[model samples]
Target: MKSGIFCLSLDTELMWGRPDLPIWRQRAATVRPNIQKLLKLFTKYNFPATWAIVGQLFLPGDPLWHGPDIIKAIRKTPRQEIGCHTFNHLDFGRCPIQEADEDLKKWLQATQKQEIKPGSFAFPFNHVGHLKLLAKHGFKAYRGPAGHWFAPLGKAGEIIDSLAQITPPAGKPKQANHGLFNFSESQFYVSAWGLRKYIPLSSRVGKAKKGIRRAIAEKRLFHLWFHPINLSDQTGPLLAGLEEIIKFAKQQPGLEINNMEEMTRQLN
Candidate 1:
């Protein structure tokens, strides 16, 4: 059997993702530092990650919103793939097709300035749509919605799954419209903020380990994703738990870690 693929993707959006939220505004300062820490952790574990950055953040000016420097850092890092999280963080599900197309065009325009033609896309809020536009723009793969049956139930289901420590489902990538692959998410590394702080770190690590084992057994993909800002609250424990998950994954036989780009190539 082929080895299982372990893919980690970070939605590297800062305030762009939650500009309407007061808490996000308050926590804005911590995003950069937490991202730096995450980069170091990935380096320590020799793990490659896909960073799906918000395209608007790549524009010039506005230190609080723009992040050209962060983009440069990810590009300079070895084995890291820089992907797109849409321009303006537009929700494709609710937006008109033309609007979605415009956003993708804008995202391509922004990233092209940096000589980056992103092949992997992560939908804003994981609300997927407009695959034809993505493939038209040359995106080969996208991080799709979670595969869990309980996912559609939204927040309550998510909290229940986290508290129950359910083994996250691992599955094979499915080909979508216009030559794109849907790399469905296996688990979200829940953030230690608000009511989520009550969930123990052990549950997160254990669930990831379980997902890895399931992937190896099923010969499927285990794609884990999280926003960088999620780590800003209680950063220490979250980072430590992430490191533990990475270390555990490293020790597992028949499991190969990859960024989204690598996985897409293998699929092709």
Candidate 2:
């Protein structure tokens, strides 16, 4: 078995990721700087990351949006794997599978025009359920909801998985019924952001360190995920904590650090 795997995925949906939340509109302008910060961090660690971008972000000009420029920068960023986060950030669990499938296809066509055929898909809000459609539409892996941190609270597992930083068991990564790999996310870098600044940087860093240690011991994947918007404010401390985890991962022997596509290929 590999020593461990370190996978970082960024859900790069500006306002579309959380359209229901009116507050997100205020943070829409912060998206570019936040993305730049993440890219800088990736460069510092010589790390590769999967950027699951909303297809609409590729379009030019919309309510203080710099879509084309951001897309160009992401494409230029080294070791960055561009992935799709649906055309309109559709919540697969809430919307009919047929509707979601249509959105997924449109996303592919849009990104394909930009020469990006993403091998990985991360459902908007992590409301994932349409696994068969993902495979049929040609995604190698989809980031699944992590196992329950607390009791299985219905669909709460999906939300908690996106917010909570938890360690996973030592086992092979599971594959979805449709034959796509389920790279279940293990942690959220920024637990809470902006007005709801509940989770401190120290706490997040501590949890990340523990997760890293656990992955090393268990020989499992330490998958960390988050949205760029979360880092729009208080970025210094958050990036510092992330750097701590990345630095620690570098010291381990035979540890496999991979993006979503690479991880899927290796596991398959």
Candidate 3:
């Protein structure tokens, strides 16, 4: 690698991102504001962020829900990279392979109507499976779950994950898995809500900075990911923490920041 790479991606699925959780639907009010804040940050930094959206979010809505606006903003943003998160946010690891394949195909066809040929895919809930299906569908890369102790535990993993925002252990980068590029997450931005809210902002920043520093010195890929909803409750603190990390990154020698798709292209 020419320099350490920092990859940032957002699972921008809205209600579909967490269909089972009522909190996702209840927190609907904060979506737009959170998006706007992130957009401003992107503009300020010329940052490229991968938005792995649930395919349903592209459908026309009745104004009460976000659909058209989501599509418009994503399509219009020059620095945003769009990726498929699945049509219904189906869990590929739990659902039948055939069912997941069909969902992927439908998502591909639907998004193509909007002229978005996604080069990347992120499994809904980070439940990775059907890589052959992804490769056949023409996805060049996919984001795996953040590497942590609970990451591989399936359903129980989700609960334990909220308790831990640990960064992945440092190692050599494996550019691809099965057939698609593996741009797995290294750190998850813990939400400033529920139990996680207890984690001091300094601690979150410290962990993220450690990841970035390790990436620069070790010359490895450091990936960070989170949902916009995670910022709904404490947008200011979370964004400020993110800004601190970004500022730290700017000072690092030869470090490059890239969206998931951009990182995949660079690897190839």
Best by lDDT: 1
Q: Model 1 off-target regions past 4 Å? A: none
What is the total number of backbone clashes in candidate 2? Answer: 0
Cα lDDT, model 1, residue 232: 79
Tens digits of per-residue lDDT for model 2 on 166-235? Answer: 5543334777578888777777675356433655666677666667677777888778888888776676
Whole-model Cα lDDT of every candidate shown, in order: 0.87, 0.76, 0.77
lDDT by residue for model 1 (50-137), tens: 9998888888777678888888777777889999899899998789999999999999898887788869999998998888888888
Model 3, runs deviating above 4 Å: 62-66, 150-167, 170-172
Query: Which parts of model 2 are misplaced by more than 4 Å?
Result: 63-66, 151-171, 191-196
Q: Model 1, poorest ten-residue lDDT window?
A: 146-155
Ranking by TM-score: 1, 3, 2
Ten contiguous residues with the weakest lDDT in model 3: 158-167
Q: Which residue pairs in candidate 1 collide?
A: none
Residue 60 accuracy (lDDT) in model 3? 76
RMSD of 2: 3.2
Q: What's the TM-score of every candidate structure?
A: 0.96, 0.88, 0.90
Candidate 3's TM-score:
0.90
